[model samples]
Target: MKIAIIGAGAMGSLFGGRLALAGEEVWLLDVWEEHVRAINDKGLAIAAADRDIVARPKATTRLEDIGTAELVIVFVKSTATAKAAETALSLLGPDTAVLTLQNGYGNAEAIAAAVGAGRVIAGTTAQGATLLGPGRIMHGGSGETHIGELGGGLTARLEKIAACLTRAGIQTVADDNVASLIWGKLIVNVGINALTGITGLKNGELAEHDETRQVLALAVEEAVRVADAAGVKLPYGDPVEKVLAVAVATAQNRSSMLQDLSGGRMTEIEAINGALVREGERYGVATPVNRVLTLLIKALEKLPRENRP
Candidate 1:
């Protein structure tokens, strides 16, 4: 298969490296010149628990160099989804499938607008990865990925892609209720990401403290109400319970938002929690908790390096 990874960041490098190691014809496309040069010169280095891997996948900083791909996997931050999809249109073949494993809501819609809805696959993954440096990533943990067409039905294409991901060591499930799956991921992020970023706590530590737990509950509960009001039936029966469960499962991990905050990079606060606030307003649902978190995180982003918490 000819594959192109659009973002080529931490998760993008991890996914592209695994597929390249599995012998697929993969090309990693990114705007970061340093990372691209590093991968092209040496290789993508993945630091794992038991072993480290260096996979030589073709990489490019220029979009024109990417060529056409049968599959394009988008791992850009949610804020960059539209621009990434627009830029990636040059790499799509006539029958190319665009898969978005991005966080938060509305990414699929943005990609669909650029690449056509029929060819878009909306999905989420629990897999964790941290970028160690240019062309290097730490495989934080392994988890399941779920994907499906936006309109919701299983197709041969979806199944085939899931099988390929599984072969590359990512356990994947082809789901019909992909929207619910996406919402489930959003709930988890709403509960965990900002809380972790604010308190400088690991996922497990959020569960250990009463104050943090109350804050997490406030965020999750408000998000659940807003999601329900918007007609999104979350897959989990009790969304708060599900969020806490994921906190336990990935206890030692620092969230992507926290990572960005610590590195003085822009966090996806507008996409995750801010999206909730936006939807809550549209549906006339109260989401004060999410709104507060959104504001606090945005405030933190503006802090000077020496003053940041």
Candidate 2:
């Protein structure tokens, strides 16, 4: 399979390298010039669950560099979805399968609009990864990925993609209601991301203080209500409890939103809490905490880059 990953940041690089190592022809495409040069020069440096690297896979920033790909997996930030889609359109002919595994909400819809719903399969992955440096990615956590068609119904081709990911070490599951699965993941992220981001602390740090716990409760409560109204079933216990449990599980790890804030890059806030607020308003259901988090993150985004750290 000619697998291609767009946005070769942390998770993208990790998957690309592992697949190539597993004997899959993987191509990594990124917008960052330095990263492109780094991978082209020094094979992707993976240093977490397994060490060392694979150099056979090729990488580039130019869309042309990513010729025809049978399956294209998008891993770019949520905010850059449109741009990536516009650039990636050239890489698709008619039968290319395009999948998005980026965090947050509304990703599937955007990708579907870009490349027709019939060619899109959305997935949510629990496997955690972080960028250590140019071309270096640290895969720190173990998790499963659920893949399915966005608007329901599936085929032999979806099965083929799932089989390939499973053999490459990314535990996989195929579900028809992939939309609900993605929402479940979004609820968990909304519960944890901003609280950890604003406090400049790790996930476990939220449980250390009552105020953080309160914020978590407020966000999850409204998120659950919003999700329930939207007809989605979460995969765990109370949304808040599940997120706190995840916070405790990933205690030492910093939330990715916080990493973006610390790096002065735009976050996926709009797709998380921001998505909630927008939906709540559409349904005439208020989502105050989500609104506040969205505002705060936007405020943080407005700050001069040098001052963020």
Candidate 3:
């Protein structure tokens, strides 16, 4: 299949490289001119725990260069989803599947508004990667990726995409309950991303420190309450424990929000924790902890680069 990764950041680069290595026609599209140039010049380098290899995938900054793709994976930050969807018109064919494996909520809706709801696929991935430099990435870990239709139910397109990803070495499942899958991932992000972004702590460090762990628990529990109020049943039980287990499992990896802060780029606080706060208000649920985390991250975004921690 011909694939286009809309945002060739760490996770995007990792997926594009793997698919290219698997002999798929993959094009990485991003605004990072240097990174795109590096890939086109030398190839995309991926360092896994077992070995390192350079995968040859086409890279470009201009969407028109990609023409029409069989599948367009949306990995752009949530802040840029609307604009990205609007600009992605050049890459969409009639049968194109637009998958959003992004960090937070409302991404599917934004894409649906542009390309119609039937063409949008909603899902989440647990795969972890870190951008070492231009055209280079470290594969921190691998986990399941789930995709499904927006309205729910297993469809041929969902299975076809899952099979393609699985063949590309990304373990993917075509699940019917994508809504729960998204909220499940959102709860995990609520417990980890903001705290790490604020304290500059690694994933496991959040669980190691008593104060941070307590705060993580409170934020996750509040999010769970809000989810319940909205009638969204999360796939997992004991959200707090599940979140801590995830933190410990991916102990050494930096949360994406922390990565944004370190790079002096804007973080996706509004989509993650801020989404919880807004949902809480709409549902009449109190999310004080999430509200505070959202406010702190938003404040940090406005600080001058030298002034940020």
Model 1 ranges off by over 4 Å: none
Q: For residues 169-263, could you state the per-residue lDDT of candidate 3 as single tens digits?
A: 99999999888989999999999999999998988889999999999999999999999998999987889998888888767778899889888
Ranking 1 against 3 by lDDT, winner: 3
Candidate 2: deviation at residue 43, Å? 1.0
lDDT of 2 at 150: 79
Q: Write the per-residue lDDT of candidate 1 for residues 1-309, one digit (tens) a residue.
A: 999999998889999999999989899988899999999999999988789999988998888877888999999998889899997789888889999998888999999999899999999888778888998998876677899899899999999999999999989999998889888899999999999988888787898989999999999999989888978888778887878878876676778898888888889998899999998999999899999999999999999755655
Candidates in order, TM-scores: namely 0.95, 0.92, 0.97
Model 1 clash count equals: 0
lDDT of 2 at 127: 69
Give the TM-score (vs. native) of candidate 2.
0.92
Q: Report, for every candidate in turn, its global Cα lDDT versus the true structure.
A: 0.89, 0.82, 0.91
Alpha-carbon RMSD, candidate 3: 1.2
| Runs off by more than 4 Å, candidate 3 | none
Best candidate per TM-score, number?
3
Q: Supply candidate 1's per-residue lDDT for 290.
A: 93
Give the 10-residue window scoring lowest on summed lDDT in candidate 2.
Answer: 48-57
Q: What TM-score does candidate 1 get on C-alpha atoms? A: 0.95
